[model samples]
Target: MNCRGRVSPGTAAPTEERSCSWLNPWVFFVSALVIKTAFVTVCLVVFLHGSDGQYKTLLQNATEWRCIPSMSAGKKESWTCCPKGWKRFQKSCYYLPADKMSWAESEQNCTGMGSHLAVITSEAEQEFLYNLAKGAATNAYETKYYIGLSASGNGQWQWVDQTPYEKAATFWKPGEPNLLFAEKCAAIHIKGKTDSNTYSNWNNILCFTSCYRICEQAVKVV
Candidate 1:
């Protein structure tokens, strides 16, 4: 049949069918392009407005599944997080439970929670913990929290996590770690009152002495 005429008996098919067939590819192409554009637009809107901007920024800058806050000066992102009721600082999460226990018991408790007793390694960390303990203090003299430090039989101090002990980096109170007594474990004694020498609050006490504890764990990337 001709391009515009209907087919008669025993005639070939009309050109309209060929024309319709030729248009199918362009129609499909346009439909697919519209669907893809709509999908991208929806995704952009959700990303820009439906989610937290701060979290998005942190995720974008994260490396190897680690979030490092730019404001922390190369430190791990504090806001990236810790478990509920725990505090975040640098790359670690700290939990200060209210119940008191012996140094060994405290260490075991921390281990059960997939952590160790706090292994404080810097002045900033010391200060952070000191302040945290101070706020939880009900009594100035009794507000002691067990840390990860312990003394070996040979008088060598060691961290529960096996961090090397450095005398210069220690924050012991003046005249502390008295070898005269059998004090073998270290704790932070919060005086409750502000002092110029705040960071030097650590004291070596009897390992079996009951005190609160600080648990430390690395932050998990969500």
Candidate 2:
């Protein structure tokens, strides 16, 4: 007897579709992308002071949640603790080089922070600062810049605090700081023995002057 017409028992049509048959990998991938986009959008909106995410509450008082950058609190791009308007010089911060200013005005610029215009105590320190003053080379018009030191208060050669001019005693032109009645302001002068030291006159001095200013209390780590 031939069995050609009889169908096999084991092989048959597939059962009804799975309950989650539509959840293919590609479908899941598109769904995941959409969810991620929505989450990010919600975060940005909250950050920009949109719906306060507390949709359940009726009152909509704004809330602030700031996120700081990854840098340490005290440290910034190049210098540490640098505030606006100050440029970093060596380890300390300095004001931008400005034209001649009266001693009182200069004092005000530095007073709030307990820092003052630069002052040099030693010959070596002087050279070091002069070189610093020549920074970047373009806008450097003067080899000498004003510092915080002054004998302004007592009419005696001294640092800002009335300390005697001690350090490596500053060198001066023979007749410098003639202390002319009107010549209270100090300016550097060429110290060639032949040249007269006139307080009213200015020069590209080849020698340092005793009447110069020096800054106290530098703000830098050793």
Candidate 3:
């Protein structure tokens, strides 16, 4: 007997099977496109965030926190901020101790503390020390401070570390170093009258004279 639609055994399925098969490729293609788009979006977001973080780190390292970029309009972009209890100028740290000691004693104390007496190598450094001395003198009984300069018995002026002191680089007051024959040490007059020169004048004095001291050490950023 003829079974018609019921007699499907060993026979290929009709339109429904073909229709479902045709839709599978389109569904898989759409699904794969959506997954690829999501993956790309995630990668782009991560890349952008990493780039921004690196830029900010660069800015921070460049200034050692002394300055940073500003996001606000009309805001200052650079500023100066020193570490606590230490003065920051350029890349050095300075400490002006109020305790009075002899030139040799001051040097010893500084070395004991991992520093040395202020060594003026540039005019900018001199200016900084001079200004600091001026301020310190206001609170000091005698306005003088021992620096790292002295002369040998042979009249050769030298830094405490034995470097030659340039005569042209001297900041002595007029008619100063007058007692060079007897005075072997150098000191800066923080608050004194110089008829024809600037303040913070240098003078040759006895090495044992007691005065305030300035300590200088390098700043390390980590």
Candidate 4:
């Protein structure tokens, strides 16, 4: 009956008399605190070295976006980033591929790249796209880049992304979208002259017309 610290020959020790010091509530609390402190320390380290270490790795690997420092109301902020070979403007990235394709084909290509054809919703954006297309043009006079605008033969125009056709901005050339040629698709035509008007450079052409295309996508926020 005295099985305090020893067992008799061939006699098994009482199972209920085992030491349970490791099961103390204080022990569990200490272990949990230690684990929590370690996790916090790791997070702080990652945050401190984010510019060149684990934080950057997570952003790059997980979303392929970079956090760039910016300023707003005299306070520091971060700017969302675009992928390589893309140009960042405002809150979107623009891509102008050299290859030419029809309006539908260009839209499909942009969709495959996780974007849609460029939508010109402001004079500033229109100017930016016009300059971009001009720079990529082999012959400015003849170069045209497909945009996101199209018509349904009812003279009602619409963007490929369906961003309120009437409420959005328009940059149509004089007497454009004419029914003479049954033109339904819009493009940004780059004139060779330096004084060419950016606001009135848009022309509606046949949907099947082959031309360069501008693709647009929102920047990814990390």
Candidate 5:
């Protein structure tokens, strides 16, 4: 309608109303973005405050635990260092002796020291160790690593911590355990030569048959 109360003549009212409808969608979008940003900001503030003391404690503990949503039942769990002389990694701890021992002998030594040969669990754990061994050893390229608990005895392999075997998670070089007449302990694949990748396969080579071992223990996280 005209300001003078005369009936309006312009026919643009319908177009203006149609254009205004788009405003609602844009408003909704902007509102959602603001809400999300606020939520993230709040979370960051809380975490920064809450985690301030955590990193220091974890450093002392020499271990860490990351919550695996898929592997998690509800909340995250904790794992700490089993002892001194052990390298702490995420959730678990490891030991690479100053002097090497035969795999079986290594197992017994680790047991005596309240630990066992390392057990490979998650791919993260695998990579953690793969990198670890590579960094610490001059011969990582050619050295085979030992893990605790092999299918060695009774065809029943168990973690030193006695965690489930989790058969589905075992990463073995194919044709392995050929059980080859009871040469039963497990060893990481290694080649006598260097290559771009740590070959996760074997080539007629077997356990060091000499010594050098890595051990592990579950931190009795109280």
Candidate 6:
């Protein structure tokens, strides 16, 4: 009998298995490497996507917080944001400091904050300022607020930024500016509840009068 064609002592495996057994180590190693590479690639992709989503979410929140609500004719519009504790309206930010100051002192205070006393350009701005003054008053007593208008230079009503104040475009009281001889600075009179009709009108007051200041700063483009 031929011993090679039959099962021999301690050699019971088939011929095909015995011939391909030597390649087992290489196949196992290659398969493990491929599995590890695929796992690492999937993890990296997931991590990157998560990080990008989180960043975008944070950016969107920041942008939304920066936008402020501006009111006009009961309609709201988005505008640049204001600093902390300041109010936003149209293209400007206004701050009413609680400390009372004379006209010059108020101007200096505003300059220290990189701003100037409030400048009213249109009726909308004037009304907005009036509302701010009313809120700041917070009592039944009338409160006066100093603005940026002054007639100190040659008796001409002028803004701190040298914008000429047009009499025809002003919101002064009916007989206001009559004391152009002595009163040089301008103020907004916030009347009490009983005198609401006379509230928020521009008045020519003494330069040394102590009053709250309305600071104005232009909103920066985002």
Clashes of 5: 2
Clashing pairs in 1: none
lDDT of 3 by residue, 44-108 (tens): 77865674354333234333333323343786453344335667777677778878999999999
Candidate 4 vs. true structure, TM-score: 0.67
List ranges where model 3 is wrong by over 4 Å. Answer: 1-83, 139-142, 192-200
Quantify all predictions' global Cα lDDT against the true fold.
0.81, 0.44, 0.70, 0.80, 0.60, 0.78
Clashing pairs in 4: none
Instruction: Quote the lDDT for 38 in model 6.
Output: 100
After superposing candidate 5 on the true structure, give the runs of residues whose Cα lies further than 4 Å from its correct spot. Answer: 1-84, 152-156, 192-208, 220-222
Clashes of 6: 0
- List clash counts for every candidate, in order: 0, 3, 0, 0, 2, 0
Model 5 Cα lDDT, one tens digit per residue, 1-222: 112223368743443222345467778999999999999999877765674444443344433443322233685664343465577776667777767666778788888766678877777777667666655566553766667645534666666667788857766666655654466566655544353344343221234465556777655442
Instruction: State which candidate has the highest lDDT.
Output: 1
Candidate 2 has a TM-score of: 0.40
How do the candidates rank by TM-score, highest first?
Answer: 4, 1, 6, 3, 5, 2
Which candidate, 1 or 5, has the higher lDDT? 1
Worst 10 residues of 4 by lDDT: 54-63
lDDT per residue for candidate 4 within 1-222, as digits (tens), equals 223456788998766765655558777899999999999999887786876553453443434554566556976565567777888888899999889999999999999888899988888888988888777777455778999988885778888887888633688888876873478899998776453666788888888989989999987644
Clashing pairs in 6: none
TM-score of 5: 0.52
Runs with alpha carbons beyond 4 Å of true place in candidate 2: 1-96, 135-144, 152-154, 187-217, 220-222
lDDT at 103, model 2 = 54
- Clash pairs, candidate 2, are 118-215, 119-214, 119-215
How well is each residue in 15-50 modelled by candidate 1, as lDDT tens digits?
555334566788899999999999999998787665
